[model samples]
Target: MSLLEKQPNTSSEFEVDSQRRHEQDAHLDSKLRTLRLLDGARAGATLLALLMGLAVLGTTGHALQAYNTSRFDASAGGAAWLSMWPDNGAFDVKPTVALVVGASLVVLSNVIALTSHHRFVRARLAAAHTPLTFSAPFVGLVVAIVAVILFYVANQSATADTLLSWSCRWRFLNTASPAPQFASLCRASHAGVDLAILLIPVEFAAFVLAGFELKLQRYTAAYTHARKTPSPVLA
Candidate 1:
């Protein structure tokens, strides 16, 4: 009777151990899935920033070209009222170039980070907790600031008493109107500015999301490490 009871007890102990291991595996799977979702979100935000940056570059390039090609017909009577020269400051492409460079760096950094996610998490797990030294957030911040400057420049160019404003005002006028000469250029500049404004928020979100993802990774690593570590032995 004693031997039969002992055999049943041994089988019950094995069943409990198997159940514990299954639970642990399930928990680990859940954590991995969560991490994947976060990484995906970070990637999405970064890609959007890249697209917006490219768009700004295109619109600004067009504006710059249009401005250079614009000519004034002093023969027209309204030529006295219309300025042939567009606002040089407003149409400058240098700022747009800077914005694009920053955005490209952000995308490249994100790619590198995604590829190294597993290794990064593993390192975090093995090492003591430390602050992240990633530069994505800082780059994103700079990009956002540049975008703001672009927006301000564009807004001022569009609204101020500049040639761009003049062109827009007379855009619907007759074909003989001198405004037509500057209209297209001004429109491109306005479009570029609008895109830059949009970029501000997008860039901010991208960096913010990246920062959040880092925190999540750190937390996950620490949790995993804690679980793997054995408890202190009792005296």
Candidate 2:
């Protein structure tokens, strides 16, 4: 028989070949979708990380400058301690407002990322969605959560007594001092800086986790899509 001649068994062979090709095409499409989502997530995460890193530096610098240059004073009856900023202080600082701005930037960056994800899903998966598509909305919810958590964490470092909270505790714990001491009274240089430093890592971890969650959503969508697509039909 000629190469193109129809054989009795050729119909079955052709169906199998077509099915395999269909599966391969479906899988390739899934991978491409996944890669696009992953790219968006990575870019957003990078920007968020940069903003948070700047926040860390700003908090540390504010704390250190206040410590080094601001005048630490106490009430006559020793009721309270205060760090009074000098207009001429070596480190001019605005921890609360600055941190708020930083937090806003973080929130903005995450919002843009999440919006991108949503648009992709609505445009691509809305019609032929699987149970996995429910995850489309759920995909970047973690980023919003991270933004809120980071905002609060940043707030801690910006608060007035944040450093003093740990400073007094440290003096009471490690020093011979039996009484709780205000930052001015204790003169502990490290003070709340340690807590601020510790939170930096926690902030970093939150962003990292958010990125992973985005990836998880993308991979799951791809898998579900591949599984749902029908194989090629036999003639």
Candidate 3:
């Protein structure tokens, strides 16, 4: 071919290469965002759930232990048995149930995250840039809702216990006996028990937050795609 003809062909080939490179870069960028969703955020969520689950799991053991202890009653000491928690007796059920439910969700979150995000640690596809597929958002949504409900149930149980305990007579049943007094430390301990009981539910909330983060992940992915794709040109 003549030099002039070859020149035009080279120019055309160069343009094609440039377009191909641009598309490849855009594709790579999209995949990176997907990795961040699955690996970065999702992994973080899984870790959060695992940690929360461990915490609530420990509380479950403690609650079970407390169940074996004596119940507070009329003959009980004034400030010592003032926790006002289900552990005070076998009559309460909410806190125990809350502990189980929260732990279940924590396990579920970790399972979903690990199973879906396995590709991050091990390549499952021929193309390393392929984005990880996300499952339904409903799984996380249900977990989040149930977790919140259980959390409130536990809190409500604690509140009722506290009110009832406070109203109980703190006096010894004997001749010329007066109402017993609680020390400042005991008073703080009473409040501390109430707050400490809430820790399990709070950890459960963290588990739910990790689950709900998937919603944010979806929105972010959609926004990223929109920004990467060029707008349609009207002729």
Candidate 4:
């Protein structure tokens, strides 16, 4: 073909290539937008998990304090003998503390993952540089499982004993009785346990989303790099 004829063909080919690249870039941008929305959802789940954990800790602590106060009252003589929570004695505070710690750790790990993701998306950090981010989901998952086990043990301990009966004492006991206060405390304590159980799904969801986010982030990074890099020219 003549040089002038060949020039037109080359120009047409270049135009086609440019248009294809533009379309690819647009597709990647759409994927990134979807990823941002997913990240937002993950953060929301993590926040909810944190709130529920705090509620468990507060209600359980207040209940234990009230139960202890009841032990000092003479009118509620039998209240001291009542088992309103785990462990045979008045109430075992250790398990509750352990569960709270585990749950807190789970929330912390999720937060770390979310932070890492944000940094990565902003190009301020690389996924490889943040090793903790990769492991955060696993850590959160394991801790959540441990917290759930502790909750199950606590639930079993309370259910197997007279805990439920004591918690409901306010309904059966006279309103003038000092034991009603003890019953309220017992009920609150168990409510904390219930809250923890109810939050298990949320905790799992946060970790799951984190894991998915991590994988998607790596893929997106690779795709972006591949698209941006100049391909090897054939001689």
Candidate 5:
């Protein structure tokens, strides 16, 4: 072919290549935008879950304290620690059920947050970006799981047994004053109380971590999009 004729063909091929590249870049940009939106949504959902879990934990703590107080009053007259009292109105049943239900709900919330976070990571990877390694939602999930287990154990066991000894006040009542036994039980119960208290901060930390992750994800996605797109010049 003559040089002049070959020139047109070469220019046409170059145009086709440039057009294809532009189209590919546009496609990538669209996908990245979709991912950014998804990540934002996942992050929001995670935050909501964390908050709900915290509320549940707080309720569980309050319920447990109420139960312990009622138990102490019932055992005051040298009554058997295990002796059922009507003063509390089915105390064991109500607190136990509330705590178990609360734990279950907390666990469910963590599971939901975890699943959303996993999806967020996958979306980031698909967009050719490094997924977040550590996040608040993940930390919150871990703390929530631990809290659930601790609360379950605390609620199921009768705190009174640890605090007071079962005895017939008329027989061998002086053998061992319930005082020492009650003290020891109180100490043990306090340990669980301390654990429940610790969860508050842990849960808060998890929520903070999730918030940071959400912000970072949003920032990174915005920066990436900005870098990929060409700036339009004013004529």
Candidate 6:
């Protein structure tokens, strides 16, 4: 064959090979991007779970402290107790606020993580020739259950002492000790603490299960993307 004639054929073959290489590179890049997104989603899920666990622990601790404080006041000279009534109300207020704020943070973190996981799953399904489903709704259901338990604990009723005692009257310059009212309040506090102890474990389990669901979604996306791409490294 003439050199000029053969040169055209060689150039055509080289162009085809270059195009194939470019397509393969693009596919590999896409796979890498999907995997990175999955990793990020999984990390976010883990962080959310940890935050929820900590919040549960904090709330439980607060409940226990309140219970102990109430019992102490009931046993002491009623009004003489540091935890009694108006004297140290601020101390109780601070812990309650902390519990609320921590719970709020946990809910926000989980929601963000769930949204990120859904995005990652959708992206993978679009790029790959596979059927994948993400179950964020189940996680939301579990969160709702936890919220209900928290609400129940927060709204329980309390009664305080209102009896008349000479010491309480002298201390507060009043005619009553309010010991009966204080005792009732302490009983309510103890009830709340018991309820909290029962609910915290359930909440912790829900958090862990949600984390597992997120991790499963992440791994599924990573695996499906690797399978579709013609790359041995990812495979």
- lDDT minimum window of 10 residues, candidate 5: 162-171
Superposition TM-score, candidate 2 onto the true structure: 0.35
CA lDDT of each prediction against the hidden true structure:
0.59, 0.45, 0.47, 0.65, 0.50, 0.46
lDDT of 6 by residue, 1-235 (tens): 5998999999999999899778867876775666566555544544545454354545444544554555566667445544334434222333333334444544554554444446666575553312111233234335434554554444442422211121123343322343324333334434433433443454455444445545655665676567578766664
Give stretches of model 2 more than 4 Å off.
1-6, 71-162, 166-235
Model 6 vs. true fold: TM: 0.37
Worst 10 residues of 6 by lDDT: 159-168
Query: Which tens-of-lDDT digit does each residue in 103-193 have in candidate 3?
Result: 5665565555555556654455423222222332234335545654664565465434432133222322221212223232133323323
**Which candidate order results from sorting by lDDT in descending order?**
4, 1, 5, 3, 6, 2
Which stretches in model 5 have alpha-carbon errors above 4 Å?
68-133, 151-235
Per-residue lDDT of candidate 2, residues 1-235 (tens digit): 7655767469879999899879877876776666566555555544444455355445444544444432432223342233232233322234333433444454454444445446676577655332332232233334334534553464365334433334444444432222234344234323223333443454355355445655665676676677689879899
Q: Lowest-scoring 10 consecutive residues by lDDT in candidate 2?
A: 83-92
Query: What is the Cα-based TM-score of model 5?
Result: 0.42
Best by TM-score: 4
How well does each candidate superpose onto the true structure, as a TM-score?
0.62, 0.35, 0.47, 0.73, 0.42, 0.37
Candidate 5 clashing pairs, residues 3+ apart or interchain = 136-209, 136-210, 162-185, 163-182
Better of 2 and 6 by lDDT: 6
Model 5 lDDT tens row, 1-235 = 5999999999999999799778767966776666566556555555555555555545444444544664575476655643533333323334334333544555565555555456675675644332332343455556555554654554556543211122111223332433223333333334434544554555555466555555666766676677689889899
lDDT of 5 at 161: 25
lDDT of 2: 0.45
TM-score of 3: 0.47
**Cα RMSD for candidates in order:** 6.6, 11.3, 9.4, 4.6, 11.8, 12.5
Checking candidate 6 for backbone clashes, the offending pairs are 159-185, 160-181, 160-182, 161-178, 161-180, 161-181, 161-182, 162-178, 162-181, 163-178
Q: Clashing residue pairs, candidate 4?
A: none
